[model samples]
Target: MDAGPFFHGTKADLKVGDLLIPGFRSNYRPEVVMNHIYFTAVLDGAGLAAEIIPGDGPPRVYEVEPTGEWENDPNVTDKKFPGNPTRSYRSAAPLRIVAERDDWTRLTPEALAEWRTRLARMRDENAEIIN
Candidate 1:
């Protein structure tokens, strides 16, 4: 594995030692069930994900550990970039929440709004999830 210091981003309130499992709907595409629980080695990347999640709760980024094997996220890996420069991975296993990270940089309101707009456009276009 990447010997991570991994992190998962979400708007869900959680406690230390909680497990994040796969099979949940994609926060980016709610109609598509995610086959893997995604995490990143980059702190800000996770923070970006958390911020864009649709919810009324505050976005949260958590330090995490994977319980099983993981692979590069095909969605953003070669598909969107040349490599796993995003440091993103997905596992068909549970990710144990280690602790909450409060020091991640937050996006500006304008940046957040822009992201929401881009996501909404993807949804309206009926973007395809790689599964």
Candidate 2:
């Protein structure tokens, strides 16, 4: 069963033993894994039993359509595109979910260092330069 807006990026082939979490939001915390399929059994009240696309098959592509509500959100950050806001931002891109094993593993040191450097650069660029 489709879980609606909350399950926007959810896949259809996800099984009962899979893990899920609120990816980009703050209200959702502590990743939850699925433990049951149907509601006939005792519910753990933890993760949801979503139907995500299995990792053994091709990735599913979802076309994103704008709902014309982003402008109403106060947290929306306006970005300058090509020096022209009118002729710049056109449409939203599709959100894709590739099937993969949901295992907990630490990133390699080299990769972590690279990410740290990238983050440092971003922080430097956004830092307030005081006289």
Candidate 3:
């Protein structure tokens, strides 16, 4: 498998209680993040607030430092969802999202199916940073 994006720097320390707030430019919904096959990474200087990608099974959260540099991720185009427009960016040094596994038995069967389908797509797009 592909090693994934390369990012060098100090790693940020995180705790379980830390919250991953969504930026104005971000669509922080768990379902959407997984379905869209978004990637998150851990980088030095990343803020205390992290971004989260929630799958039906579990949620993955990433911590990344804010940088002045920004580039368009070729994997995704500008998304126009009704009144909301979601933009995607790529970093030369992408951070990784680390999350714990938990049982989300409350999800409907349809939702579970969708999550699996999206996860497959995510794998195909290499949207995740595999260490």
Q: Indicate the worst ten consecutive residues by lDDT in candidate 1.
A: 1-10
| Tens-place lDDT digits, model 3, residues 32-124 | 332112232322111111212232323323433323244444443333233212233454332333332221123356764775577667656
User: CA lDDT, every prediction?
Assistant: 0.92, 0.26, 0.32
- Could you tell me which 10 consecutive residues in candidate 3 have the lowest summed lDDT? 44-53
Candidate 2 per-residue lDDT over residues 1-131, each given as its tens digit: 11111112223344433433222222111122222111101111101211222224422222222332112111112432233222111112222222323322334558547655664564556633111
What TM-scores do the predictions have? 0.96, 0.22, 0.31
**Clash count list over all predictions:** 0, 6, 7
Best by lDDT: 1
In TM-score terms, candidate 2 sits at: 0.22
Count steric clashes of candidate 3. Answer: 7
Top-TM-score candidate index: 1
- Which should have the higher TM-score, number 2 or number 3? 3
Which 10-residue span in candidate 2 carries the lowest summed lDDT?
A: 38-47
Task: Itemize residue pairs with steric clashes in candidate 3.
Answer: 41-95, 41-96, 42-95, 42-96, 45-65, 46-64, 46-65
Q: Candidates 1 and 2: which is better by lDDT?
A: 1
Q: On a 0 to 100 scale, what is the lDDT of residue 44 in model 3?
A: 19
